[model samples]
Target: MGAARVTRRGFLLGGAALLALPGTALAATAPEIADCAAWGARPNSRVVNVVVQRPVKILVHHTATPNVTDLSRGAADALARGIQNFHMDRRGWLDSGQHFTISRGGFVLEGRHRSLEALRNGRKQVEGAHCTGQNLVSIGIENEGTYMDTEPTGVLWDRLREMCAYICGQYGIAPTEIYGHRDFKDTLCPGDVLYGMLPRLRGEVGGMLGQRLEGSSVRAASWPVLREDDRGPVVEAAQRLLRGAGRTEVAVDGTFSAAMAESVRVFQAEHATEEVNGIIGGESWPLLAAPVQAGDGGEAAEAVETLAATSSTRPPSRVGPEQWQQLLTAAR
Candidate 1:
């Protein structure tokens, strides 16, 4: 099919129906997604605000459930309701954690209440609960299936690429910003099989949108020693960690500025001794990147434990190694 055109009138309406052209064919703009109500979702009990800024990345997740073969719309709708019920009733979340759900049959349904409206506007994002530290700045898309053992169906994969391309074009996001959920979290979400497909997915999205593909979101096993004046996503990640750790002065923007240097110095002073320089070296990255479990004796973990021991009152007496690990991970 040809590229779908958007009329000025349609753009002004700002309705979910304006997401596509008058036919069932996919569009260059946002895909024709079924809203939560259309999928028989119950109304959210509380109010939700769309984040004023566009999301910096798109996080992909797999439902981690059985790969259901029923490809009917009713099945897809039921899947959406079940996920919403689980997230709300069991997980105690306000609504669905993900912003969108892609069915094995290629159906795309808005997961959260306001997610479709936000996407139609193309200037804001609905905050998601999919990733802990990334909830505010990342868009979450959950594909329905377990991908650890098998790959997604061809229909599901094609629709995902098209939806991602449309989202990227609308938000001015780079194709490289697409990432598996495990990139930022500790769990193996989006699974081994689907996560392996991210590169090809990114490439196809870039090709479709005629945009250049940049770097992937996966962090190297070992990060370079970052100091003042260093700048990039790594620095941004550090900044986010600092902010989460209660260093509110540091901005999470990608640039490593003077404020960031001071924040890093404060964190170093509180978490590690010996050297209080604002540099993030082998001693700091692990503590800031992810939780350090027991038997996880790296240089960074040792430094963290040592610092925790020195604290006179904070971290509470009841806090154990696992709790400490959680505190540090959330900070990162």
Candidate 2:
């Protein structure tokens, strides 16, 4: 097989180019992927957007489907088709929301169009619809079953580890960059059990790629970093927190302006007392936001409900207390 002639900037086909992704020397082995056609995917409602940048992170999600006894290739194929239809028809997406999917049977299949090609090239990405605020920079992998309390099968776990190593190798991403869906959004996606297992997943993938995942944590949840120019519900959550903390000057708008940045830095100075970079990442989020439980009032409570209300297709308190606890745990 001819190696893709890939450069940091573009891909040239049918040349013996080095496939070692930028900033890494490890040779990535592309796994046997069942592309969209192989899984009998419906023609995309429209062309998938292929972005010209390597993804920096991997987001794991579960289909929230039943944990069935049947674990077969046929089931995997059916699952792929079902996902495409739901994303296209119901969610009104061009194709499946994720870049790839792993079935309970441990079959690895491509989800969105151009995703396999992008992976093979190792320097481009297909924009995903998986996480609202993070689709542009992350690759989403949907595991096949609901895993809130139950763990995935042994085969499923092994296959997921292999795929993560492959993706990390291909994209030159560190194992620490692997995160669960709930990290970025206010929803229970890659459920409790699977989310908790991410540290093990990162460690295993790092071992496979002969790489080190520095700064590893029990969960190492990657919250979307909010800078001055960033926008959306997470930013609003921060703003509301500031407003509630007596920064009456801060408005509960969904935009992260320069004033907000200064406010964040000031808050960090007063409370967090380190990494006063004015960015809401692992270092500052837990300090800025608090979890809201039943009948809770004040800005923290309002901010949690604001995130819930802002997220379409989820319940009123979809970004509920359980997920907030998980975030605080992982970030700390």
Question: What's each prediction's TM-score?
Answer: 0.62, 0.65
For all candidates, what are the clash counts? 0, 0
Cα RMSDs of all predictions? 14.2, 13.0
Q: Summarize candidate 1's per-residue lDDT along 1-332 as a digit string, tens digits.
A: 12344533244234322333232233344556888989999888677767788887888999997898898899899999999999999988889999999999999999999887776667789988888778888889999999987999998998898788767766667778788876554345788789878888887777666554545322212223456677654566566656656677877666888777778788878885335677665445545644545556443344344434444323333434445443333333
lDDT of 2 at 120: 71
Residue-pair clashes, model 2: 0
lDDT of all predictions, in order shown? 0.70, 0.75
Q: List the residue pairs that clash in candidate 1.
A: none
Collision pairs in model 2? none
* lDDT against true structure, model 1: 0.70
